[model samples]
Target: MTSPLLTRHGAVAGLGPDAGVPWHYGDPTAEQRALEQGRAVADQSHLGVVTVTGPDRLTWLDSLCTQQVAGLAPGESAELMILSPQGRIEHVAGLVDDGATAWLLTESAPALATFLDRMRFMLRVEVHDATEDWAAIGEAVSRPAADGEPVTWVDPWPGVTAGGTSYAADPTALATTVRPWRLVLVPRASLGAEIEARLESGWTLAGTWATEALRIAAHRPRAAFDVDDHSLPHELDWLRTAVHLHKGCYRGQETVAKVHNVGRPPRRLTMLHLDGSGHSLPEPGATVLGRDDAEVGRVTSVARHHELGPIALAILKRSVDPSTELTVPTDGGPVAAAQELIVNADGFSADRPPKPGPTMKGLLMGKGCAADGGDLPG
Candidate 1:
C-alpha cells in the first residue's frame, strides 16, 4: 500500500517484498539530519502490525516468546523474539499492550500471523493481521505515549533491563541517550492526515534510509536486515533487552541457557568504522577479512550517518580480535575498517568458575615462616 504522503512529497516509491513504502523523498542527507535532531517523522506504514485478542493474550504470548510479557502493563512497550527449537531466531516483534489487545509490530506481518496461528492449537487467543487497518509512524522521541493511551512501542535499545544482560562493557558508550526513537500506531485511513499535521507543525518527513542509518549508529539490530536463519540472541547482543535469562521455559530456552552458560556463541556482532575517503560504502553481505586477510565474517548492515560518516554492523567469528584491523570487499578492491566492539570476544561469561577462597589454615598462617622450618600451624 503506497502511502498517500507519497503523492505530496514526490517520494520515489520502493516496493519492499513485504510492503510498498517510500525509500526516500528527494534528499536523504537532510532527512537524516532532521531525524537525529528529533525534528522529523517517518512513514513506517510498510511495517506489519498484528493484534492478539482474548483474555489469555498476554500470558499466551509470554509463554512462547523470549521476553517476559505476561505482566506487561497497558501501553507498556517490550520486544520479543521467537526462536526455533534449536535456538535460532525465527521471528521478532515490538510489542505494545492496550487494556484489551496486544499489538505486535514486525517486519513481516503475514509470516508472523501464520506462525502464531500454527502455535494456537487449543489456546484462547485470537491473532489478526492488522496491517491493513493500522499503520506505524515513527519519530525520534524520548518516550512513548502516556499509559492507557494510544498504541505505541518505545524502543528499549542500548539499555539493560531487568532479567537481561549487556554485552557492552561500558554502558556510558550507549547511544540511546543521543538517538532515541519511538513508533506510534495510527489508523491506516488517518495516516495521510497525521503526516500532514506533523508537516504543518514544522516536522520534516524522513525515509527508511534516515532511520536505518541511525539504527546502525546506535548498534540496534533489525530483524529484516540483521538476522539470519542461524542467528541467536547472544550473537547480536540482543540479550541486552530482548531475552529474559530466568524466564519460564519457552521455545529455545534450553539452548539460550546452554550457550550463555557453558558455551559461547560461534559468532559475535561488531560495529565497523569504515574509511570513507574512498567515497564508497560496502554493501550488505560484503566479505569481512581479518588481519591475516582471511574471511572472518560478513557485513549485515551498512549506512552513512550524518555525523559518523560510513559505518556498518558485521557478524564476526568469536575468535576475531577486537583490536585487529579488518578489510571489507568493495568494488575498489577493499576498504580498511576498525572494529568497535559490540559483543565481547570472550562472549558472555555466565559459566565462569567462582574464585577460590582462602582456606582456614591459609588464613591463620603468618607471612613469615617458622624459624625452625616447621610447617605453619592450622
Candidate 2:
C-alpha cells in the first residue's frame, strides 16, 4: 500500500488520493528547492502501474487511444489518452514499451485495465493491473536504469510530437518544457530499501508537495487534478502531446476532427496568480469569479511555489477575457487573481486553418480545401 518512508523524519501524510504517500517533509521550501536542483527523489508509489503483453499489443493500442503507438519503439516514451465516443478524455497514461511488454503508468489503473480487456476481442493482448508488483519514483532528470532496466516513461509534455498539433500560441515559450521529468517503475517489494539506498547515497527525500509546486510553476497538468467529466484535450491544450490529428480512426476521432477544424473548445485552461497576502490557499473546486463577481470558472490545482508565491491552474469559460482580473472564494474571503493564458482564448490549435465548410465525412475524404482558408496540415 504505502511507502515505508512515510514513517521517517518530518514526514506528513497527504490527503484524499494522496493519503497513501507523503505530502511533505518538515521544510517544504527546502524540499522543493532540492527537488528542482535534482538532489532529491520523490516517492510516488501511490501511482498505478499496468502491463500489457502479447504480439498484438502495439497495434491493438493504436486502434484504441488518442496517440499513434503501433510503431512505438522500445524505450521510447509517449503520453496517450483514452477518450469517450464524444471525444472526452476518460483515462490518461504515460506509456513505455520494453519490446515484450507495454508498461503504462497511470492514475486510473483498474479502470483502464478493465476497459482495455473488454476491447481485446480475439486479439492476442493481455492486460493486467500490475500495481501490486510495481511502484513509481519521480525524478527531475532522467537517470540510468537500475539492475532490471526498469521501464521508465519520460514525460513528453509541452512538446508537439509527430502527428500532434499545439494549441499554445507560443509552444516554445512554455516554462514547462525546460523542466524534464520522468517516472521510473520499480519492484514494489524492495521500494523502501531502494529509497533508503538513494537517501544513504545523499539524495534528499522530497514529497508530493515539493513535486506539485514545481508542476504548478511549469503549468503541467495532472489528470487527477486537472480533468473533469466534460474535459476535452483542446480545453487543456493537451493536443500538443496526446492527440494525433493524422492517426487512423479511433473512438473519438470524429469529435476531435470536428473541434480542431470547425469548432472551439467551450473552455480554456488558465494559470492564476493569486494574492498570497492571505494565510490559506483556495481549495480545488473553488469558484472563480470575473467582473461583477460573475462565476466564470473553477480552480483545478493550487500550489505555493518557492519563488512564485501562490499560483493555481483553473479552467475558465473561453468567453472570459484573459485580461480580466478574477477572484476565488476562500475561507477568509475572496482572493484576487490575475490570468496567465495557458490555452489561447480562441481555444484552437495554433496551426489549424480557418473553419471548413464541408461535413465531417467530406473533410475526412479530403473534399474541402481553400474554402477553409488553406489545406490542413498533415
Candidate 3:
C-alpha cells in the first residue's frame, strides 16, 4: 500500500500499520501550513475505496445506511453510516454516484465489502473492493482539481445540509469556513505521477497529521477516531450531515428517532483547548475528569495545530457543564482543558412536558357540586 512518492521524497515513514505512509516529509509545521494555505497535497491512498455496480446499487445501499441515497445524482456527494440494529455506528463512508457505479470512500474497505456481500442476497448490486485499484488524494478546494479527474467528493462538514441540523453554538470555529476540502480518486498507478506533478509545481506533500489537525479544529468527528461500537449519530453531531432524520426506514432508524425525539444522548461531543504549557499531549483513551475529579469522558482525538497549540475532541457526559473547567489524565499527571460545546448540553431532544390533568376541585365545580358532594346539606 506504499506510494512511490514516499521513497522519492525521502519521507520519515511511520511505524507499524502506517509503515507505508509518511508521517511528514520533513517539517510537519510547514506541511500543516501548506495545507492550511491550500498549497499541499495529502497521500490518502491508505484509505479504502469500494465500488458498487448494478442498477439496484443506490436503492440497496440506501436501505442499509443512515443517509438517503436512492435519488443521488451523478457527482453529488453524501456520507452515510451503517448502524447496528441497536443504532450504534458500525461503518461509515463518503459516497458518490457516477451514473453507472456508486463509489464509497471508507477507512476500512475490505470490511465494508464483506459486510455488503452478506447483504447482497439476490440483489442486483455487486460490491467490489477497489482499494488495490484506486488511491485517494486530498487537498483543500483552493487547490483546484486535476483536469479530467471525473469523481471528487467535497467534504460537507460543519455545514447544515437539507434535513440536517447544526450543533455548534459558534459558527466562527467551524473549519470548513476557513478551508474547504475535497478527496479525489485516481488510479493507483497514476497516484505517484500525480503527486510528483504537484510537487514539481511547488506544492508541498502533507501527511495525515496535517489533515487530522485541521479536522479536529473544525469540530469534525471521524469514524476511525471518534466512533466506537456503541457510538450513536447524535453523540458526535453526525446528524448534521450523515443522518437524514426524515429518510426512509433503515437499520437502527428506531434508535435514532427515539434518541432524537424524546430522549437525550447520554454523552455529548466537545472540543477541548488543552493547556499546552506542559508540552505533552493526552493520548486517545485518556480519561477526562470533571471539576469533582469524576471520570466524565475520554479523549478521542488530539492534535497540535500550527496556530491552536494543542486541541482534542472528547465525548463527555451530557450533564457536564460546558462552562466547567476539566482535566485530562496525561503521562505528566493531568492537563487542564476548557470546553467548547459541539453537541448541546441538553442532548438535542425536543420532548415536552405532559399536559396538566383537570384539578379535582374544578371537576367537582363543573359537575355542579361545591367543594365536596352534598356540601350545602352538611
Query: What are the per-residue Cα lDDT tens digits for candidate 3 across 1-378?
Result: 887767855587654334567777778888889999898999888888999999999999999999989999888898898999888899889998888999999987889999999999999999999999988888887333344665788887767667665555554456535767888888998998888888899898898778878988888898888887768888888888898888889999887875664455777899999998887789887899997899999999988888998999999887788899999988887899999888878665322223224553243223322111122110
- Each candidate's lDDT (Cα)? 0.83, 0.85, 0.80
Superposition error at 373 for model 1 (Å): 50
Clashes of each: 0, 0, 0
Q: Quick one: how many clashes does candidate 3 have? A: 0
Of the pair 2 and 3, which is ahead by lDDT? 2
TM per prediction: 0.89, 0.92, 0.88
Off by over 4 Å in 1: 14-19, 147-149, 175-177, 349-378
Misplaced by over 4 Å in model 2 are 143-148, 175-177, 357-378
lDDT, candidate 1, 244-356, per-residue tens = 98889999988787666545677888999999999778888899998778999999888888888999999998888888999998987789999988887776543233332
Q: CA lDDT of 308 in candidate 3?
A: 90
Using lDDT as the measure, which candidate wins?
A: 2
lDDT for 67 (candidate 3): 92
- Highest-scoring model, TM-score: 2
lDDT tens digits, residue span 1-378, model 2: 778878998999988667789999898999999999888989999999989999999999999999999999888888999999888889999899999999999999999999999999999999999999999988887543444677788888767788888777556668444566888888999888878888899999888888888887777788999999989888888888888899999998887887787666788888999999988789999999999999999999998889989999999988899899999999998899999888888666887766545565354424243122233433
